[model samples]
Target: MGVTAVLGECARIFTHPRMIFKLAQRELNVDISTDAYIDENRNIEQTIRADERFYLELLVIQAADEEPSTHKIEMYFITYCRKLSHNREASTGPDWRDDRQWIPGINMDNGYFQMHEYQAPAWAQHLNHIPSHIVKLTTLNTPIHRWSLPGVPDRFQVFIKRDDLSGAELSGSKVRILQFLFAEALRQNARHVVTGGCLQSNHCRSVALTCRQFGLTPHIVVARVSKKEELEAKGNALLYRLAGSHLYLSPTCSYESFSQRLRSLAGYISDKYREPCYCIPLGGSSPPGMFAFITLFQELIEQGLFDNFDDIVVSIATGCTAAGIAVGNYLTGSKLRIHAVSIALSKEELTKRIDLMLSDIGLSLGTNDIMDIIDGYIGQGYETITNVSANTGILLDPYYTGKGTQGLLEELKKNPTTFQGKKILFIHTGGKFGLFNGEMDQVMNLPGNHANYINEWPEKDIPLVQ
Candidate 1:
């Protein structure tokens, strides 16, 4: 039966003076006072219609009720309840179900809401808040480790946020960003995902792995750093291959060219698959992706690490992650200093990009006092820094985190007064797999020992018992 028919039948069957009695109908089963019934009814209807899967399951239960078999009816009812519970938990988080936070209400300023109370509307261009969603693909809450690294200023304490362990193959800041991007793709019923990055781009690999995990086909257009490097599948490229991603190589490495290529590739994929194609910008630095770090700030608040840091340092390329962090700080009214160490973009460029990103979320750098862009770390250009460093004893990718750490150390040495009495938290955005690529030759230059090296081995293999 149609939803209206079902609801009307419920109203007729419940026949009571008070509207609260109508809520006891089997389809709803909500217990609320008469005063709350109007608001509750609107919320209940919204919640029920939010997910089509839930509505379909309810219809299935309704259909099974007419069947003669009681066991079959119970099975359908149980299935519907399980789905309801799972969706509820995913939407409202751990134990905030009674609050009906998943039900979107009209915000006074924006006329939109989110699944979580902490999240604003995803696309709301308002002056109040940013956004987050519940399409979790990997486990988050990477532990923060305190560091006592050499050469750091005496009065400054350092902590590293281990985002490297965010997932197995999907580890890094990209995964957090992908959670929202892929969620939007799924909402659009997209069957193909089109994205681009460098040959060993960690972002591309993370997207490929996430797409495979979500039963979607990934098409990656990898911009070539070198002809030789393009020929080899190493680091993130290896993961792309293993994840069954359709790989394409582009000669241009510039973001503008890369975006144009992505658009063409997306069109091709849509035509080929006879399905919709979702294109994620380079580094997944879209507005939705920016929310990843905004939500991350929320996570840090929960961990009690929010107020403890005087400065938060991150290696920024496209600058979306840093922008999100800045927005979070601005929204929360915190005076946390956000250090965006440039990996590729210049100080002026980074500032402009970050300013634009902030403006996208109804925030501006002029009004927001959280942004601090530290450049001069783009040593030997963007593609030249292939030799990864381990100053923090954590596996920081050569592209982002390594350069960022180097910059942080140098900044500490040069300007001791700035970080003298402050606490610094460096974000370790993981790119461990990038070390396995052709860049290993450059990294192994000073090393006599390797991970595969053995101290001693038997002269002959032992025979099998069988």
Candidate 2:
């Protein structure tokens, strides 16, 4: 299904006063104008038709910066769909769809929108009740800032959407994931939150800050730094310690071994503490985490950030951040092409991971189906820096934002056609402290004073004496 069809359907079903007025004035019937709704429906149906093994389930609605009132409408929409369906699978089932239903609504004195599911869907089923709490995040309309490397394309203006400045300590992309994580933690009655990541993980730092804010203890399991030379006391590591996070370090191990260790640690923490402990995977790369980006995209649209650009570029690390941003763009009916610069995984592997994450959340998005443009710009392996990366890191961090920008610049150079006359916005998923130690020395190659060159001065004092 095409995006336009889905948008048209959204306009019809959402049925705002303005939308209703437009429809009335245009004399367009809802039945005729509802083709937009079928775009996603057709896409889903086509997949189901093509694959007999796959079954259709509930419609997954990823909530973005939707207000409490607006969210209620979303909840009602899902609930109605469930109540109207005959098959249990057809109804809104467990996962994010169900999770969003219980999200509490904020009280508006004006009574703008109510949290009432007036007419339930036919597929509604009374199952185990789930308690939910709404998380509040401050979304801002900050002006876009653009930076670029020398000799880059004139049309390709690299702009950073500063989610890093969302708050002082709890800033960056991690805050979005923490909102849902903390809410879930409270819902499960967890006293401590456990998560895994690298030594200088932004997600870990943000999680720690969130735990502090909500009066919950945060325990972080950090992977051992393979390169001793890269270890430093600044950036995310410093923030994590400052936030009073319980740190657990794992020795050198393979990827599977690392996972096993993290699992064992989580189990131990849960058993020893005798209190519910929530474990958040590395990068907070879950459906809930993806919702943060969805909300971010919504906020971006509300702030009119997409007005000047036809393309959006983001750096892909665990693929979760990029996935979230991609999904958000999809949901908002934005046709803007999304370019993801993979920092670690190949395009195929990254797509698989993203698709699995989406499916786990009961939302289906094919990696190939997603509008992501991947380019070969990851100079070295994950967390490994190159000369170009180092140069970029001299001005930006290598961990998240800097590497991402560097990749974006490289991709822009390679794909001149798309970037030639189009404005590109790069989402800087903050990791600045990763570039602190001796980065300048490596990038600039500065020489010691009075050591490299002899002073070019004449012996004027001797001539005056003669």
Candidate 3:
């Protein structure tokens, strides 16, 4: 902490790549500085971190000439040094580039010089504090990872928000929505929950599970397009049975029809029980449900993700979360542009949904707000997309994430001049269980030569249940 030591460290760090790489490689785990990135077209570049204790101190050196260096070594030494200083039983970390070895215990790889593996120091405060109105549901705050895929343009960077890891049994983006809806139900002094969706609806499954968790009984009215699907308890239906929920499968086509059918059903439930009930609209896209996604955007800001992203992309089925985030940026006074990649709806339809949700929350998003809908990703229907995950270790379901990602790539290609220097942040809405509903024919029919591909789909990730 002395002036002399600080002066010596500064003189040592802001130097040439040979020195930085040599020093980093020599000790590797003890140095505070690493990754000497030099811009090819510019001389002035800086990496800024808001919270000093939580982030590795980044200082970029400006050169008089334009020269790109390939030797930008990663500095995980600061992380190791902090561990040793705190007397936390420190040891040398293994190579971060090894995909096989994980960052110790978190069941995920520590990417980019083990930067991903490091945790916030003890001095760092938790970003998300539960609100007075909301009770504890599943654990909040999922990890975000930098995702690099083959065939993607090198200039664009992609990151995924891991909403799938939000819970064990009810792991999906639906959990966040349930957290807010359940809290609102409690505030309204409701006794039971009434919600409706398709047979394989993640939203209904989450509602049923969360209702039981908080001592409220759940009544689910499930609707399918056909009589055959109505009779079957498949995918999300299995979870409903396991949760012991009261389910009624009604034959219907659209959310409008389902909502119409659910209204009479919800009325009957209240009359039968002689108690108040909270009724959630289809896909939990109401005003209260969108609160979780606003919290999601708030989480991104706390973690300093908003500064680096030029475009934020998310898949939309019901368009609730996408609408929440788009309007959330406006609520947070952020000018960040949101691209709602449509899996089912058209750009006009998605825009209407966004407009409707914004109205539900009583916020008016002008026509020129930071919201754009990029359509044409839905191949056949909501149940199918063209992109396959043949050992990519990431699964993007056709209903949402896959379609959004495909649209993002296409958008970049169509408007190359605009997105040439842009960075993308892809919000992954989880549908891992839905992957088991159909065959992996679209994923397995790989025609190109790609590396680091797992080749075969791991059936073990989602075990079959009788």
Candidate 4:
């Protein structure tokens, strides 16, 4: 049907407000009078229709913020639709005529405006379960684009979600989780934000930067292998010094020990400063932080990325990001299998951490049911480089994204049936700063590729003429 015909019919059928308010998800919001609504709906609907390639799901309802008014009653027209392009067969979107799928705001034989509350299905309502108050720390809706792997089969399709571009300094999936963590920290009127991690930890860097932005002192409890490692200021450690973060270096690297130290440090700071100190757990992977990925899953659904990918792979350190995504997938009844490569902990230990995180969020899904924990890729240890050669030209750190992506590629090559011909999305969790930790010295010293270099700027003797 034409845009004008649909909107005109809408006006005649609904016995309610004169103004037609349109809200496009994550985009436009406009309040139009009857004449303006008619004129503008044509352009908006035509843009939305996209030559019938997209089917617009329009929901007409009374504005929940407003009460009934005689002169004018506010009616909202919400537009929602999923993009239809994937390796799998495309889905013909919902049929508007199907009454079961939608509840239209229409009143017959009554001139008075009526309010009809649209109750989303249980799965749809799952998106609303995140923590309400959140600090906007990272850039969201990061682009998801197709990626080219070196040795992948022709049939298989790979995509990368660029969570690494979330922010300049606050880059990575850690910043997303920290959004919730720091929000809670500020809410508690905290003077010092205490967190724990290793020497060159990305999580520690993110926490420190966020604390500086929030005008709170960042106290980082770092687990160190040696005193020299603690003394060296490089990579994320340099950022900690730049942000004026207080570092507490400890010899014990145990998670329990780190937690105890963080609590003790926060308590001491509280007593010394005579102010509240908020202690964020290691990697900010707590119940409050898990909401970051849960909400990110909702963003995927809105962007039409949820239905396209069959499997999602990510690197797991503390297991909070994986748990959040898995919970969101389980709640939405998605068939996507979540695969997490263990960057630090063993499969058993990481699974235990994930299980506990889920339990804190009131979910009780077993490891097998929620995600596929892929181990055997820890290499020498955490923050160490793996020897897998699956170069895709994308900048991934040696710590997290590099290890996780190499694991996925090895799986696709070794056991093709597991992921062959399946659309896969790999989440780049971001640890770019860790690359400068002197791990790639041999590779950097090796012979460089001289074929790409050309003398494009020939001496430029004429430049002095200016």
Candidate 5:
């Protein structure tokens, strides 16, 4: 009853109607319906299937949408209602029980269906008919692996989404944002990139690498942290340097002023060098950059990720990725929740940033964000380190992932009864390099964690290649 339960729900929705009725019968409380919008010519038949263990295996939504395609909001909404028929426990009240509550309102703009809770899907792909054409950053549909922790009450299931393996250099959730940011740069035919982030910012590393690949120069501006040494120390900063990005630093902590200064500097560079310069905001939190997660959430659906988990937890630093995930679920009719744990900012600051991004994308759907924010984690801002990564056997960075994860874990431990039988996904947005700080090793290694390398190191000398 781990993520397999989610897989079951997903599988039932995509399976043939014959299989669905059979599955519903087996489950006793399940319902399957295709009468939401009748286009007899439309095909409810899917080309995907379930696997062993009643798991909801993955499916790649075909990029083509003719009429209420699974890729579109209309069909996804209907399909989600169908799946909700099975998992009726997550929500409460008559509103949750009524299928009509899930029925989308007609899009006044496009005549397409939109959720009552969110704007239409087109707003996600394009803001006011302007395209957010994102470049393909990486082809990593990271797998969700299941891990059970000891000493946790109820033995509730936990699944971790490995975005840490999203790429070799352009790793972490930030790359998803860069996919759109860099695509915009390419669209503008820019020859140089300017961006800002914290000293060890993963977005900076991702942007620098993208610039290297796309033949654009990258200049990074950051305010000084007492931990400025940690930037040269390792992790994302090391990768940023390795990508050969020009570095600009402000000794003061006036980040907004620093961003404006960087903007001015980019203009100067553009004028002096006679090449177009694109300036990216901190953490790539613009509309296009934020829309990358919309693409990512869709990718999760196509990859069958939605079928495997109930909740997704992430570190919400600047709120870009979290905004995407939250909005994507609404746009795509995926009934999933993103639990965003604050890494550095206050919840109000996080909410404000997300709202600002939504405004940028021509949306004013709800005053309340579509996601939940947990801010008990940022005890000393980005300085306090928690060893949750060690206890959970995951590689969480001391500043960001570890501290945030610890907050979530402590809350879960305190309120175990609330999440009983629920499967949670902890997204491991990659910052593996942060494990090594400065020239000195920051984290103590667990015994035998690296033993596999030596034991399986080609048997010392198998044979030289011919």
Candidate 6:
């Protein structure tokens, strides 16, 4: 007879002796010694204390079939484990200076148990957002292609998985973030959603679009752009206006002040209209927001994307996405390397931020191996683009998939042997719409040879005589 069962919260100890003994007796029908002495000195509690939510691991253990087999015949079980906890306050966040001392949390430990089966919603069963005809060009489906740079070896095959192409107005990483935000808003019965970002924020645009989709009004607080700027009408800003989103411009206000202002405005609107308003932090870098990427990881697994790659690279902005991806990777036991490229924060600051995020998700590092923190690409600060990045953007955007590609180029150049024959996938998070606000001109000045294209082409009808 075959035994198959789903375990909830007990899969964390897939390799534990006690777990093995129990499985052998229950599933294999083997008479294992119940009085067998087991070592209790294992710091299982400490390990579990590092990451509470990560305590859940899905395990599939099977006993092979044989004639009169000592082991069971084709017995398999999938279980989840909850790590034990010391119940201590988690460390403030990750330590940027010390990679060796970093510890992830273990708060969700209650021991592994079976999960109850649940049916999918009728509406959810028939819903399909991604078109069936468009082949998903991800790391799992296609071989990564390398972009050649001077002095970089062709052996470095760095391919970008275009998460940016998810949609036109709803393009980029923020789309996934907005999916969760809208779901939560609907759950809370919110009539209006409020958020703030820079003058050219893709996140802000996504929030506006999501609000429109869910029949909720969006109120956006934006910082004023400099008057000297030549704005483009084809990017995210244009889309936001077209979506009929309400915009509020803030001049000479600090981030804290701007947040306070939004709160005050929300209160006034709520009082006036008697409708509930939902406020999201800048860039949607909150705990619930991080679940967007976690859910993405789940989708990737169901699609079998994790089976092909040994490492995954993502462009890090606020660090929430990176943390979520890391936690998801850990939970799934995909064992893929997560290389995060710092775009805004420093190596130290990013580490701390990710650590805090993981803590919020009930997971911890706690002297265990966590994701690799790679900094070195953050040219100046958030939104600051370097000459190389500009060139990359020109080559890769409209597509907004170049900064991470550039970083991958540098990484491959620095250590060609690291990727020797391994496949690498770069997550192309969307920000092309943000780039459309004439910001690229300020960051990436056009070459003198190309100046004629922009300046002389409109005026001159004929080519200049050589």
Candidate 1, 271-378: lDDT as tens digits: 876767899988888788777887788887777765678788888888888888777777787667778888888877777667777777666455235777888887
User: Model 5 TM-score?
Assistant: 0.63
lDDT per residue, candidate 2, 354-463, as tens digits?
A: 88877765566686666565657666322333433433432345666656766776666776765424677777665655554344335343353211244556777457
Candidate 2, poorest ten consecutive residues by summed lDDT: 43-52
lDDT of each: 0.64, 0.57, 0.58, 0.64, 0.60, 0.53
Steric collisions counted per model: 0, 16, 2, 0, 4, 36
Q: Evaluate residue 244 in candidate 5 and report its C-alpha lDDT on the 0 to 100 scale.
A: 78
Q: Candidate 3, overall lDDT? A: 0.58
Give a tens-digit lDDT track for model 3, residues 1-466: 3322332343333322233333333433334433334323221222211232232223222110212121221133334334433431111222112222222334442221111111222222122222224445566578888776435676677777788787776787887777666656755645578898767678877887776655466788877645544445556778766676777767656667778877777788779877667898888887655666777787888777667776788888887888767756766666577777777777777677677666555565652375776777777322223333533467666566766777777777676554424677778778666655554455444555232245476787978889
lDDT of 4 at 35: 61
Could you estimate the TM-score for every candidate?
0.70, 0.62, 0.63, 0.67, 0.63, 0.58
Poorest 10 consecutive residues of model 1 by lDDT? 89-98
Q: Report the C-alpha lDDT of model 6 over 255-313, residue by residue, as the tens digit.
A: 56877877887787667667677887777887656666766677556656676666788
Candidate 1 ranges beyond 4 A from true positions:
1-118, 121-132, 225-229, 366-369, 380-393, 445-466
Runs of candidate 3 exceeding 4 Å displacement: 1-132, 225-230, 380-388, 417-421, 439-466
Q: Which stretches of candidate 2 lie over 4 Å from their true place?
A: 1-132, 137-139, 146-149, 225-232, 254-257, 373-375, 380-395, 418-421, 437-441, 444-466
Worst 10 residues of 6 by lDDT: 130-139
lDDT at 399 for candidate 6? 24
Judged by TM-score relative to the true structure, which candidate is superior, 1 or 2? 1
Task: Estimate, for each residue in 1-466, the C-alpha lDDT of model 4 and write its tens digit.
Answer: 3333334444543322132233222212433345633442221221222322222223322222233232121122222212222211211222121222123464332321111222233453444334544556655889899887665667678899989898788888888777677656655656578897888899989988777665577888878645654466788888977888877778876788778888999899889877678999888877766777877788787867666888888898888888878777888888888888888899889877787777666675676688888888876322223232223456777778878877887788786676523899888888888877776654543344221233466566647556
Question: Cα lDDT for residue 411, model 2?
Answer: 68
